[model samples]
Target: MISDLFAKIRRAFGDYAVDKRLLQEAEISKLPGFVAEYLMTEFSMNYPSDWLERLRDFVKRHYFEASEKEYVKHMLVERRKIAIIDELRIWVDLEAGEHRGIIPTIGEVDVRVPADLARKYQMAMITGMWGLIELEYSPDTAKRGPNGELLENPVVVVGFKPFQAPTSDPEILRDARQYFTLDEWLDVLLNTVGYNHSAYQTVEKKLAVLSRLLPIVEENTHLAEFGPKATGKTFIFRNVSRYTRIIVGGMISPAALFYNLRTGIPGEVAVRDAVVFDEISKVRFPNPDEIVAKLKDFMESGQYERGKQRVTSGCSIVMLGNVEVEEREGAYVPVEDFTYILPKPMRDSALIDRIHGVIPGWVLPKIRQARYHLSQGFGIALDYFSEAMHTMRKESLVGEMSKHIEVAGNITIRDERAIKKMMSAFIKILFPNLYFDNRELEIVAEFVVEMRQRVRDWLHKLSPGEFPKDTISVTVRS
Candidate 1:
């Protein structure tokens, strides 16, 4: 039965369907899933029988480890030119009157890029782009400081081949969703994210796992998920989308999150679709008052002003943290207030209140290799899947809520908007055709309400005076 379903998925998606096992077999786990899959598909189509060997060779040659930075630079200086596949970011040096590229693997930040190339791929200047970049070493092109000291590297970007989807059309994903039942669609989502659907036993569990994607598919959505470690919270964010920037445990400066006052460059929140704060409890804000103040404004209104720049972005904020969980009556439950898991700067009631939803991450099972946690069946290519979700952000299905659902009880305006945004995201992912009946709408409404209610519950626990116990009720219109 499962094989048949996999066959159907392959037939439906055609070239967009990639066998997830290929990624492991090729030993490209270090690369993002989208980039790995894109290389696999491209090589397989171009080199049939020896595609695996060719793909391995391609990765070995082009992809460089941080340790190989000196070697790569040596090759560039000796050979005068070298091509490498890496996440390339471009930033203009106004003082020098040149475009600079940051190739992370090679640890070269001052590599020069042609103005035309920068103009062509502007996103690289913003959030960076993964691509095959050819660099040439030209000693004459090197800049000199006023004191005649060498000011920058001589490496110049000569060519680029971006590793992105050929086209991004959400309608393709939407049209495809209609062919599968809700259960099958859920499995498809799981498989697409490199999970084995059969390993997950229940629909609720599957939905719990899928809730991690809410911030990705929705605009200006703020979410928090805390549970025991190893729940694959960071894995999905890292591998699933290039548009998401994950900041591990460290001090988060206002410059990094919003805008760099010195560089005149927008930060992660302005460039990426979602900014995930992994291990939130350990993350520090250098200027707590300043950073938290700006964060609250951005989370609430999607607008932030740093220095002379006032920027508006639809980027969502997701906080992931580990918490103490106890098994009570055969169910894992959080023993402490969820807010306690956040860093001190983020524990403000006003900041917490701005969060739209809280995912009960304890419900998800730990990912393990022996338990068949990885997908073996066919799934959509990550590059394609990421693009589809990014494109979906431009669409708003919130109007559907007012058309079909009604809120009851003492729900705050924030709670209502949160519920509506979440439900709309669910509808966009599950029922893009907007053809669901009242029963389906009610189920989705209830699920999203529970998500928002979790936020309200946390608020009540944190500041009972400010946020009293309130019931958020929703019903599908008859």
Candidate 2:
């Protein structure tokens, strides 16, 4: 019956059956279809036929390819060895004017793309994109760094094909309701994020889960959530879309976020659909005040300037971090006693006010064995869904929500803008076909208002001196 449900959408997965025991152990089925496919394909190829026994032995010996070598050779000079990398990321060094390709599970390799290949995939390479690259790799010390340190061995790319997003038929989106019921489509959307419909038993819970997806479907949005660990706050942005870029833990510079003055090229902000800063507390900056200032301006207006070049990006920014919260009398209380656990410089009211919506991660159940939704349901392919959302971002759906809803008079203009942006994003995600009636529209509007209100409530509590005492309220006009 489960097979029957998804039979129409299932891909022709190759003959190699995934090890049943391994699948359960790795919890691969809990992942999105694409991610599961990738793992299954890779595991079958790399592990032995008796992988059950071999995997146990491999784990006993602590043989992880990643940790064995500091900088492992994922891409090799030999023809047979080079075939392993299905997708590679080519990094362009702006200062050196050199190119390098990174093979996942391994470190960086010096890249030399032929002029013709470079010219052909110029846009992709310039944006530091992922692609299947045919490279001639060698271990010889090709060049040294500015500090005279030996750089990794270089690889010459002989050929390549950049990954392209699948185009959606307008008719398909227009008539989506005819093909699938509303619940089925919502489940599919949930599946894209590795969630099982069964896990969320209520509509509010489902919408809360869906709120995390708003950034993916909306442009120039600012969203943040701080709460318990292991809630999959950063999972969708990392896995579901290639259009998104996730910075795990590191120091971020203005040049990296916006534009590099020396390179005269726009940064991740200009190209990526969603840029997620995971572990917000751990992400350091050279100049915190300066970066926060620029980020606030950009998050507010969707534009930024670096050096002499003024750059604009449609990317949504999301910040995810863990905060200590405990249950007290059926209510969650912040153990840290702070509105957010972000960097000290980033905790300002001005910066907090710019955030469109804040999901209460504390309310989200911690991802455990039972919570992981390894599904048998059919869903849109991650790439296709990503493209569809990106295309949907161009449509002006803010007016749809604005016509029926009005914010409290005390709410500032920025508050109104934040609420409208959030409402527009939710509409695109939940009602893409624009088929909802007034009652449905009211429900959606209130959901959006509540999310924005959560952000404002925190800002007011955190900085009562700066923010108004009268909290923001959304009224749906009959």
- The TM-score leader among the candidates is 1
Model 2 error, position 198 (Å)? 0.8
Candidate 2 residue pairs that clash? none
CA-lDDT, candidates in order: 0.86, 0.65
Candidate 1, which segments miss by more than 4 Å at Cα?
145-147
Candidate 2 local lDDT, residue 25: 48
> Residue-wise lDDT of candidate 1 within 1-478, one digit each (tens)?
4498799898889999989887776457778888998898899899999999988988888888888889988898899988998898999999878898988877877788999999999989877999899999887878788987777887789999999989888777877877888788889989899888887878767777888888889999888888888888887899888999999989988888899998776789998989999999899988999989999999999998988899999999999999889999998998978877888778898999889988888887888772388888789999989888888889877886787888887888898889888887888777867677777777778878888888888989999998899988998997
Which candidate gets the maximum lDDT versus the true structure? Answer: 1
- Superposed by TM-score, candidate 1 places the C-alpha of residue 246 at a distance from the truth, in angstroms, of 0.2
The local lDDT score (0 to 100) that residue 440 gets in candidate 2 is 68
What does each candidate score in C-alpha RMSD? 1.7, 5.7
